[model samples]
Target: MKAFIVAVVAAIGLAVAAMYALTSNQRFAYQAFATTGARVSEPGTNLVGEKWTGDPNTNDKSESAHGKATGEPSHPKRS
Candidate 1:
């Protein structure tokens, strides 16, 4: 019983560590893209671009206007 409990606890700890690693990796990738002024998006027929600035619509006029008013660029546009 004690061994079973220890194994369960170890499994849970491993799962949490894996989740944290995955999340951190994703965050790092986003940060790298933001720093480089690049975008990442899903491949599709529309082929829409996604800037790494944490916002989704940087090129749309309405979104841009709103972002400017809020003093935050909706997405960092590649210069």
Candidate 2:
């Protein structure tokens, strides 16, 4: 039982030491953080707090795409 406890403690210590060594370098640590941060989450709000943004979308589908050509025209058309 005592040997088992010592082994467990040694493993935890070794793991911590490994982590510290990996993160001790400033350049490598920051590069790892930046690359990891971009891949880990969606591009959403990460701020501390938010206020009432208000209902900005009071009007919906009110704009029209009238006379919009779908395809490229062969002749040069005047705008």
Candidate 3:
């Protein structure tokens, strides 16, 4: 029982250490947002908490076709 407890504690400690090491780097711990304004789940809210207008499905097909015709990569608005 004592051995099992020690093993579990060691595992938890190692996990915590690994997490700390991974997040300690500036690259990993990047703060992209300046303020915590609104939730993205709310209506009209984008990823950056900015007001998003227009329908997401309404992508301009003409622009994509034009790009393709010009030998450029056709960037579709869909994810």
Question: What C-alpha lDDT values do all the predictions have?
Answer: 0.47, 0.40, 0.40
User: Candidate 1 or 3, higher lDDT?
Assistant: 1
Compute each candidate's TM-score over C-alphas.
Answer: 0.38, 0.34, 0.36
Clashing pairs in 1: none
User: In order, what is each prediction's RMSD in angstroms?
Assistant: 8.9, 19.1, 16.6
For candidate 1, what is the lDDT?
0.47
Encode model 2's per-residue lDDT on 1-79: one tens digit a residue: 9999999999999999999998565332222343532422111111221111333232222244222222332342399
Decreasing TM-score order of the candidates: 1, 3, 2
**After superposition, candidate 2 runs with Cα above 4 Å error:** 26-79
lDDT of 3 by residue, 1-79 (tens): 9999999999999999999998665230112322254221322122322112354223233344211112232343496
Candidate 2 lDDT for residue 18 = 93
Candidate 1 segments exceeding 4 Å error: 27-71, 74-79
Question: How does residue 39 of candidate 1 score in lDDT?
Answer: 35
Which one is best on lDDT?
1
